[model samples]
Target: MDQGQLVRILLSLILVVGMILAAAWAARRGGLLRQSQTRRIRILDSQRLGARATLALVQVDDREILIGVTPQQISLLHAGAAPRDDDDFRSHLDQARSS
Candidate 1:
């Protein structure tokens, strides 16, 4: 290969790598790659049930819900007021421990 061809090849590789890195950086900075953050809804916890199923605790507005999730479906299992303070969290923990 001639010097011009080698330089072109090198420049193309660098441009491709730079584009990929720039896209990744933009996504991270823009929060496009992160979970949605909203005051009305938040995922508090989750546990995998099987290969494609999970149980999730989601807080929505003033309430929390227990949801069952699978690759094919989503179902609500329970719903209640969400804990808003340390005392409420402690009480819920105590109730869970007792039960």
Candidate 2:
């Protein structure tokens, strides 16, 4: 192809990529791309025990669940009412660990 044609194609590609990036930036600034404020389920915390194993504290509705996650399956360690504070969560975690 001619040098002029090649330059035109390159400019067109750059312009398209620039437009995509600008649209993403504007959406993020406008909060259109962010996660919603009101979600029913939330992961309170998690700890990685091994390469493929994780212990996660998840809150759903008004209850909290301690779950063990692995590649094979997810197991519920404990399920109880949501804790009021971080300290309460820690105590629950300690109790779960001991059991």
Candidate 3:
């Protein structure tokens, strides 16, 4: 291709990339792809066990649970009520943050 044609191709590529970035920014800014408001369950912590396995601490409503997960199955390891005291919950949160 000629030098003029090469310049046009490069400009087009740059414009395309800039447009994609702008679109992504706009979507995020407008909260078009934000997390669901109705989603109740949240993962408090997670650790990888193997290539396709993980252990996760999940919080649902006022309950906390530890679950073992694999590609083929998910198993509940433990379940307990969340701490009711503010001080205890804060300490637990601090411990989790430190880890």
Q: After superposing candidate 3, which stretches have Cα over 4 Å from the reference?
A: 47-54, 70-72, 82-99
TM-scores for all candidates: the values are 0.52, 0.67, 0.60
Task: Compute the lDDT for candidate 2.
Answer: 0.95
Q: Looking at model 1, how many pairs of residues clash?
A: 0
Candidate 3 C-alpha lDDT tens digits along 1-99: 999999999999999999999999999999997998666899999999899999999989778999999988999999996668998889999999999
- Pairs clashing within candidate 2: none
Ranking by TM-score: 2, 3, 1
Candidate 1 residue lDDT tens string, 9-60? 9999999999999999999999888866666888899999899999999988
The candidate, 2 or 3, that scores higher on TM-score is 2
Query: Which stretches of candidate 2 lie above 4 Å from their native place?
Result: 82-99
Note the Cα lDDT for every prediction shown.
0.92, 0.95, 0.93
Model 2, 1-99: lDDT tens digits are 999999999999999999999999999999999999799999999999999999999999879999999999999999996548888889999999999
Error of 2 at 21 (Å): 1.1
